[model samples]
Target: MGGEYELNFSCMLKPYKRVLLKLSGEALMGNLGYGIDPGVVEGIAGEIAEVVALGVQVAVVVGGGNIFRGVKASASGMDRATADYIGMIATVMNSLTLQDSLERNGVQTRVQTAIAMQEVAEPYIRRRAIRHLEKGRVVIFGAGSGNPFFTTDTTAALRAAEIDAEVIFKATKVDGVYDADPQLNPNAKRYQSLTYGHVLAQDLRVMDSTAIALCKENNIPILVFDLTVRGNIRRAVIGESIGTLVGGFCEVS
Candidate 1:
């Protein structure tokens, strides 16, 4: 809120270049039931600003659970594909809002959607998106891989692999992946680092199995960290040894 306040939170220590940040839809909610909270949006933009200032090229993939969930609606009898399309639109709205917020802070951003929406945003082009990143423009990929039955998590992995991101940073409520849900189980053990095999064997829900498999096959690493804590994004990047690193322990041939 204040100069010193933001200064203290950012630039603590970390220099990063090129990272993928995954934000949940609920992150846009600030002590409220639903919708985008201005304070929450600004706070997150601050987090992005902090890292972008560190000479890092940032890309984001935001979720749509805040407004509506097509999957949940479909369970109530709506067609699954239709429900998913609705969910995809919801993500586009969230992406637009995020783009506006980031640009307000003088952070250059671009919104590329998988679904064709020429009037609103650019269509997803892997080479173009990579160029945007190289040019230091934060690119936000929206529309959930433009396919039904897939999730933003999977889309994040797909994009990360396409862009050659060193690691995918998943910002969650909990700081790191745990053996069990820490909230429900007080004795849950937090894993500082986890292998993809261990996660698959243990059935950890950090990311959907499909997403994990895609990243595993692509040899991309995943870093799960807490976005609730300010500047944690930057901390998790720059190889800070924060959160859980899953898969790709050995480089793929």
Candidate 2:
């Protein structure tokens, strides 16, 4: 499974041509309490490169909690809007780091920020972003929907719909969606498949309400899987059935 042939084999089995990947800033923290972990970023980049090699188009929406959480700041007394703007900047920083790592992995990438910073990354243009993906360049979206009070999860769903992605791949610490926090409740049941209505009604908390609703309205599917598992990203892309599939009715293996 470590050779070029295997990579090609996986690519050949992929059911999706394009996808939107949602990365939480907290996941980039590795074991640290805050900030990006270089090793973790590099590993993620390597995993992305594998997907890219398999000819799947990838677009990413990254959160900024590792550096700053606007909601937390606002709750602590900063103006909500201002705190959220600062949080957007944090995402741009993470986006650049991800771009750098992807480039180092020999994968072409683009960092498009919703907030303009010409000196660093390109401003977000939906058409341009789609063009990059078509060219096999990884498009990394930063800044939370270019507005305050919006989570990166929403950004991922919005971008996925805009780009007409087949699915939204949510990489989380937990392997999949559960009836309860799996770590806290060992007996919690993991759902292999779920409907959008069921998730909303159950208050799954898998993604923010705004994000989940957006996907539901657009009929986009979501796959929630563990990012900690080194090859899970590539596995999910190639339809290995390794996650919790939400929104669409699909047979689960």
The best candidate in terms of lDDT: 2
lDDT string for model 1 (176-213, tens) is 88878899999987776666666676788879999889
**Candidate 1 residue-wise lDDT at 106:** 89
Best by TM-score: 2
Instruction: Go through the candidates in order and give the clash count of each.
Output: 0, 0
Error of 1 at 132 (Å): 0.8
Cα lDDT listed for each candidate? 0.82, 0.88
TM-score of each prediction? 0.91, 0.93
User: What is the Å distance of residue 236 in model 1 from its true position?
Assistant: 1.3
